[model samples]
Target chain A: MEIRTDYADGNYTIHVDYGILEASISEYIAAYSSVHFLVDQNVYALYKDSLLSFVQHPIILEGGEASKSFDAFKHITETLLERGIKRNHLIVVIGGGAAGDAGGFAAATVLRGVDYIQVPTTLLAHDSSIGGKTAINSGHGKNLIGAFHRPKAVIYDLSFLETLPHHELLSGFGEVFKHALLKDEETVRTLMDATRTKISLDMMKPFIISGIETKMHYVTTDEKESGIRKFLNLGHTLGHAIEYKYRMPHGMAVMLGLYFMMYASNEKAARNIFDLDSFRQYFELHGYPLEHLKAIDEVEMMTLMGKDKKNQSSDATGFVLMNDFGQCYFTEIDSNQLKKYISQLKESL
Target chain B: MEIRTDYADGNYTIHVDYGILEASISEYIAAYSSVHFLVDQNVYALYKDSLLSFVQHPIILEGGEASKSFDAFKHITETLLERGIKRNHLIVVIGGGAAGDAGGFAAATVLRGVDYIQVPTTLLAHDSSIGGKTAINSGHGKNLIGAFHRPKAVIYDLSFLETLPHHELLSGFGEVFKHALLKDEETVRTLMDATRTKISLDMMKPFIISGIETKMHYVTTDEKESGIRKFLNLGHTLGHAIEYKYRMPHGMAVMLGLYFMMYASNEKAARNIFDLDSFRQYFELHGYPLEHLKAIDEVEMMTLMGKDKKNQSSDATGFVLMNDFGQCYFTEIDSNQLKKYISQLKESL
Candidate 1:
């Protein structure tokens, strides 16, 4: 299936299928004057022969949050230029979120701007690859430096996910869960039921599409994240803090973040829409490292949360509070209030 | 005079007047929740008291081409983050092209993007500030890394030019001259007449406005420089090569680049539109350092031109060649032909 995105700044399509990577890449190569591939090192190792058959010298990048740094950004851009990447040339980013973010940013700023296609190998990238948001982590914070550069297309081939480890699959599913939560109670219920079974591409494909669509809904309305797009960050405020503090996988952190927010903002109606007990059971069943929530230093997490780009004031941390499924709004909670909630969340977890 | 630009990507006004800096900045400060100033060091020193009155702790930047580096970009973004610059805050860039380019890029990439106002302090900036072409020099070439991020407004306070050194003024005029050449012969003649007399605020204002209008014409029509916008780069191909080689003022190199291209693509109608000899005389009269053209190493220059972002192929260099005023086309000339033209240009110089 193909999902087309209509953003205020740009428009592109997302193609999701079982084994469409080679054909999609070949198509782009035929369309553009030239193509440059920026692939995850692990993905390169896994698919070395097939990748080499198509790409001349794909730029290999370490595939993790750590690789999304200024140094990596410089390396990718410098390497691309050295290889004579030009304006008309397309940069095909074949990796998870890290390679995509850094490589997408390189495509955004290199030669003022160039076109790129996102080939997501991880389930987590299903959400990230759809948005034009490209960034490299600054020393101060994650994704502190970036640009809203849209990709020409996103080719998500699920066959690659077959090689992903259990933890990595869980990492990507975290975002899928967040999307389902943001969508509606029905989606949340369906996603919960889907994950109850052993993870498979067939079980996840529909959720992935729905998740990207939900993300695109906010992104298309506010490409710059000035308004509704902030809704997409429902769990990310605490998610980023957790990821930063514990050096955990992004999606894994986000899953915990979702539980914390749901617990903190546990409105009567929201609880009716999303049952906290069942969600806890799901986490425990999936082995989501709920223990990390108990270990989080409230002060450090609060400090990191305060630095979130979404925050409007220094005194408060901004959050996307969902009163119920399909309903969310941005609110700023004072540090003291937030710290109390953190304590309550830890005790509950 | 105020010139409003209508670019496809964005629209902004260019305010060309004397002593408007203080008022313009004050207006923005009153409007935005908060404001940050990124000022050229020299400009800050000259207007320190006045600037301090309006801005607290202005980010002072080195004012020339050397500062347009990735390191400077990192420093600006890091420092801004350190100082607690948020999304709603405005970044008022007070400098010439280099500072504006670097600072504007920081505004563009920091937090994905933010709004910025351009306070052009040099004549050259009247052109650069309006276009939203923000960039930093890469190891490979000038502006090899950047984005097409527009400013909210450009406060072209002519008062800043009063403090500019002669060469700096010349650098700015190079763009004005290029704009005039891009425009009809009437503009060229009028600009020539204006420059022939003592350079004064009143004398330069009309040309600066006209020059900006000329630039906006191409920019508005083709914001990404995919088509007609290439006309604006008539002199820049060789001009950038000259600037990179000699470390000369941008406009001065452009002035010589203009002369060389005019000579190489010396069509009969074009000569009628722009007199090469008189244009050369204008450069000499204004101390444009034409001897740099004589010092040109053809091979080195060819290599530099080959690396220009505008080039489409390795075998040839792309150039904007004019048959007459307002009539130019993009063409690719082989290295040998370009080198022969370079030597011929050297001999003529």
Candidate 2:
């Protein structure tokens, strides 16, 4: 089912065809025509041959999470400097979440700020790429240092996703599952029901667009994460700490985090729609877990949450708890209470 | 003559205000409705009542050159969180150049970007108060780690100057003097002429404005200090090293750096424009040049420039030597040029 929707705020466009990439990028540059660029390295490598038919400037870098560090920032910054690219010029990044994040951070900070375009290549990046969350890892933290630098434009082509392994597809679905759980009730029912049907590559365009729409709504409400959008972090507070502690991918960590948050909450709105039993069975079918809260150290996990960027004060950390589908609020809860909630959930599991 | 000039962008009024103690920040903030404030504690103590009447969010910090370090950045960023000020909030900063620089840096980095206003309360801040240059000092060097963050507004109330000491006035004027040599030839002449005339504070307006205007022109052209504005650094490279070695105030160091650079280069542009006879005579009258540049390690000075944010590369360091009034360019000059220049100046002295 292609979920029909529209966004006039003009941030993102999903492309299902390979034919539109070059022409769309050229049009953006012409409209914003301050500078030109060649993405010489990194995720740009993935599309070097294909994009050659389009872009004049090409820069590439190694593709991975490890490459999203300060050293990479330094390398990319140096390349821009050598090319004599100033504020007038644009840097184009086309890749997965890591490439988009790192490139966007570098572009924003270099010479105080320059413009850049995002052509995200991963299903997971469908979430990571659109938002203005550009970051680089810092001492003992993932994305500890970053900037809220919005991209000039985000152009996504679904044609790129056909090369994915099954796990990659599952990982991407994990984030879509997150939006469904936190915001859209029908989305959760749709995903669960669709599992029985053919979840083909082309079938996902609408789902991807839906996830983008949901994320954009959250972003527009609180771009700096100072308001209701803190609810978006509902699963991520414990989820990120888990990602660090267990060496899990971000999507996987969020899945585990949601599992615990769902069990702990007593919201009638959440319970009325989501089938906890079906979700548990689905986790098993997907080779995931609904248990193992005991595997993580409670004290150590809270310690990492202490360093989370959202918890900026002495008294409390901001938390996003789901109240109803498609609605949430940013509330500061007692860390002690959070410990109690999670501990209770572990007991039930 | 009291010159009331608008930047042609805003309706700000510069006045023939009394001593720095008499400067009214309340009127300034009221005129421009700022949202958030990051101010140094010492300055806050002096004007907390006045400030509280205006700003909704206030972040007070300790005062020092070292306070411009990243530790202070972390502190203010935490305060921003507690107050819950997001990207859209205005950040009002009042204090010495150090406070404005550090506060501006903090405001710029938090949530990526925030609006900033400056109320400079020191003689040295005449330069720092206006320019978009904001930075934190590091073990590596001063202003080595910084960003070119423009202030939304600046209030240069002369009242802040009355609290300044005589030595500080002398130190701050070093930058003012550099501006004179680079652009404001009449201001340069006026400052020298003032040495012969009675150097009363009120009598010094034209000279001060001339220098301010000169620096403003350079700032407008090269806000990031990437090109033509480097000429403003003619004496700064050696001046900063002098500050590091002798532990003098910034203006004093720049004055000495100026003397050395001008003496080193008999180049018509550097020499004819930065008139040495007037410089020597003025310093003699002011009882400055408290220490000589004897046995100074030119190599160490060159090393310090490496840590300078302007260098852009390892082998190439940029210097803006005066070519003529209102004209300067950032040219690549190696340590070899630096050594020969310093040696020539040392011998001449």
Candidate 1 chain A least-lDDT 10 residues = A267-276
User: What are the Cα lDDT values of the candidates?
Assistant: 0.84, 0.66
The Cα error of candidate 1 at residue A193, in Å, is 2.1
Give the interface RMSD of candidate 2.
6.6
Query: Which prediction has the highest lDDT against the true structure?
Result: 1
DockQ of each candidate's interface versus the true one? 0.73, 0.13
- Candidates in order, TM-scores: namely 0.96, 0.65
lDDT of 2 by residue, B1-349 (tens): 1333334443233333443322344544454323676667777777666533444445777785866755676567656655555444567787888998888877666655666777777778878776677766655557644566677666666755665678887877777777777764676676677656434466555667776777667666666555766677777867777787777888888888777666655453444655677667777578567346756777877776655555555565566665555555556677677677766666655
Misplaced by over 4 Å in model 1 are A7-10, A200-202, A267-273, B8-10, B197-202, B267-273
Model 1 RMSD, rounded to 1 decimal: 2.0
Q: Where does candidate 2 stray beyond 4 Å? A: A1-19, A26-62, A181-183, A197-200, A267-273, A292-294, B1-107, B110-123, B129-132, B135-171, B177-193, B197-349
True contacts recovered per prediction: 0.66, 0.10
